[model samples]
Target: MDSLRAAIVDGRNTAADDDQFIERLAQLQHEHGPMVCRSIFQTLAGIDLPRDTAEDYWRQVLYRRQQLSRILGRNVDLMTAMCDFLRSETRYLPHPRLVEVDSFERIVYESMYDGLTGLFNRLYFDEAFAHQISLAKRYNTDLSVLFLDVDDFKTINDTHGHIVGDVALKKIGAIIKKTKRDSDLAARYGGEEFVLLMPHTESINAFILADRIRQEVEKEEFTAHDLTYRLTVSGGLASCPLNATEPADLLHMADSATYMAKGSGKNTICLFKKDKRRYLRVKLMQPVLIKEMGFNDSQAYEGKSKNIGIGGILFENDTPLPVGAHVQVSITGRNNAPLLLIGTIVRIESFGPNSYDIGMAFSFKEMEKIATAEIAQFLKEGA
Candidate 1:
């Protein structure tokens, strides 16, 4: 109640918009109950009234104020009525000292947001991340974190000067904001890095969003000093309950995965590998056909499966595929029938002069049960 009074007094003194003042009153009433409106009405009316009567009068006042606002095409002042009532009752007038509501709001906004990129700063992200972790723990929901770093950021600064580098960072920040979901929280995690907190999301979904942001950044062009250049970012995703429930551990996993993405040649997204032993991996050197998801059969290339697992497969290919690229894999099943599976390339490493080892995680949500069952059988036979 005292806080409500202080807010009202502050609003009144600042010559705040009447509509904003009314909104504050409405918010206070929502938080503290009808007692807020009742107190305001009783005090202004200068009469001791029952709770119901005071609340009823307050409601009527609100309705009339709305009608007058519509008729006047502007906010109708409730202060006028309060002053009139006090004068008619020969009561003492309420006086509020001068306070700057605009300045206070600005201060609060600046504290939480970065002035350069307009994204949440590190301090705000830390506080919000802790709160989200608590909520996810309480609800047993999934939470994913995406860590991204600009590829060759120092090179951009050194080659084009700090002003151009700042422009590139700002452009990347805008791209992230445009690509991410409204519920996701994006923050500048200091110096060429950003973090995204996605509540109630799994690693795969987080990967999709992160990759989209990466692609957007790659495609965007930044111009400063009459020179235009493009930027790319590498991202890593880790989820709670799937990776680690501990916040620090999950964040570290994401950061480490980002480093892996950078090591794998940047501009890609990597999912944190929780454990290699989670699924039974069978050593099976078999010929498999591979192609990007939307490509034609003629465009499909042949790769040999070095190992197979219920969750994923490790294959050796002549050409290296980008991490996070969706691909279709066709492997010969035990029945001699070809088993086609859709999966995402998660890891890639050069094996030889013309060969690369590619790790693919299966998209179980899109795969049929029979396909997974067949893979299980193959793993069992090869185990």
Candidate 2:
């Protein structure tokens, strides 16, 4: 009730649209109109407003004004009548100090919350992130940030339409809201991207939560326009005073971890691990197409990427390509764009009865570009 009153006062001071406030007012009148009318009528008409009749009268004025007019066989502005009654009886006036505070609060609310999801916006995130960092630094507390991206979100938008895309985003928001604690801060970082700031939390705890969110989203089906679609998200989590000491570095680390998660698979969560390897290998669960360079081998072999790094990749092959044999590796990017790399078969190990683990070392300069700074950072941290 206090919050409701504050919101109403804020709305009035900020010159916000009055429909929401008016509706709230109507509901309040409907619920407790008898005692309210009795107090007001005594002040104005010097008489009691009958309980039984006043309840119905206020209900009609609040919720059934149009129907009441028809029933009474007369058109009347019930809102004005109610307000006039208040004006004559109650000294209904907005306090100047309260209005000033209300206006400030409205401004803050608009700036902090996302217009669509009702989650905190990015602007507020920057402040919160810095504040959390300060608290962690001062008190030696743990802090973690999870950076998540919806898998194949572009495909959802392309196939189901933008409206359905919006539905998916909103559902994800609701899931996060339901899954997270009040202490955690959730923000829509951008389109198809979200950031969860968990203060005084460990990286493993962050990963567990991220995985839970991923699994729940995967299990839930989004229905729109009679089309049902299941979606998944990949997340990367980085901890403060562990992986990073600064805000930008922390965000970068989390984002990098998220990128690795996406590259490895679309529905998994990964923790920031700064591997010492020259090339950071990410587990790729999807199939990769491999072909011998210059069409030397006309047949293209199908293989699943076990892991991918800047300089090399480990993959499964039934008939292992000979060491030193050069081949072209093609995989799908996040946008469904094709990525091609040239590498030499570096190592092969027997895995199963018919399958072999093939390690290929990339030789292309473009391969270097593909291994991002986040991956390098992870490697360096381990180093």
Candidate 3:
């Protein structure tokens, strides 16, 4: 305590020093796990430590690392940090372990497809790009990529905030999601920009979809902070087999077309003119929902949420919910009073056992601000 306070008072080390510490801590990971971390902290504190207290402290750190692992969706960095800590003491580091190709393949497949939009991701650009190359090598089918970006998205986030930004994204996502048919692939490449893969598509067809998406985004009004704003997107379309056989050539072509659109101005679509290079983006926002909850560990709590736009929620094995059953919902602090709301399962998706997601429309009134705010706060508090 005295050393920590002195360190803080003297500005010796801030709490965020975990970065450099993490590197040193990585070396001790193998021998003591999180205990090595706790021991190091105790050594720094220079206090006589109780065995039980040290154990508890280490346990808490372990829990926090595990929780972070879940959020980051990867254990590599933290695991590597611990292993490095071990190496410092022994002058030896753990050898690299080989990963199975099958595992890599599976993750790559998942990476290619966007879970939210059901389209492919930026990674799939390579997939489709390569596929096009193969086809061009053999048959002569043309493939095209339309790199579309939402314009002035920062303004949306600046004006309405991220919550509203989320709404815009979902709205735009819905629009793009519906715009593409069975043959087209769409993905939220990063923030505001989306990539579309059109197989066996002509530049004309890709432009048609691009124009439709732009117009739809422009016409649609996203409401945030009790204000409505029009949205629009800029597009750059580049075709393969016609423009270039190489993937880089296709990217360069599309990048050029996207640039021309941006250079000319806002809310317009432009296909790559063989050598142009530019990119302007479409503007959009979307909502973020808190997927997990932390209760006081009382009795089982109910989880209820209604889709603002979609039909009823799914009730199937995919969501881990049983068939024909209604769920209990607790919107954290707001549901301090039991909700008058009820939802019955009407439909289910095909995913089974892992858990079934339910398709349910609220039998009661729309949830009030308190519920939503509480949920938003819960997520913000890092709970």
Candidate 1 wrongly placed segments (more than 4 Å): 1-98, 274-307, 314-360, 363-383
How do the residues 113-232 of candidate 2 rate in per-residue lDDT, one tens digit apiece?
Answer: 887787888877886788678779988888999998999999999877889999999999989888898888899999999999999876545655776777788899899898987889
2 versus 3: better lDDT goes to: 2
TM-score: which candidate is best?
1
Off by over 4 Å in 2: 1-105, 277-383
Tell me the tens digit of each residue's lDDT in model 1 across 1-383. Answer: 32333344555556457667777777767865666665565333334556676567666667766766788888777855454444443334355333355765566567667888999888878867876787688888889999999999999999889999888888888988999998998999999999999999866667767877887888887899999788889988898878888878988999999998999999988888867577679998999999885433437889999998877899999998878777789999888999887877767899689889998877465355334654676788789
Error of 2 at 314 (Å): 20
Superposed by TM-score, candidate 3 places the C-alpha of residue 138 at a distance from the truth, in angstroms, of 1.8
Residue 339 Cα positional deviation in candidate 3, in Å, after optimal superposition? 74
User: Each prediction's Cα RMSD?
Assistant: 10.7, 20.0, 23.3
lDDT (tens digit, per residue) of candidate 3 on 1-383: 22122222222133245545454445444533444444444333223445565555444544556666687796534334434343333323345344554664455447456655555566655655565566556776767788787788899899778888877877888898887776676778777778777887756456666777887888897886787888888888887766777877777777677768888887887766543232222221221122222343424433334332221332222234433343344332333443233343334445445544444433232233234655787788886
Better of 2 and 3 by TM-score: 2
Cα-lDDT of candidate 1: 0.77
Backbone N/Cα/C clashes per model: 0, 4, 60
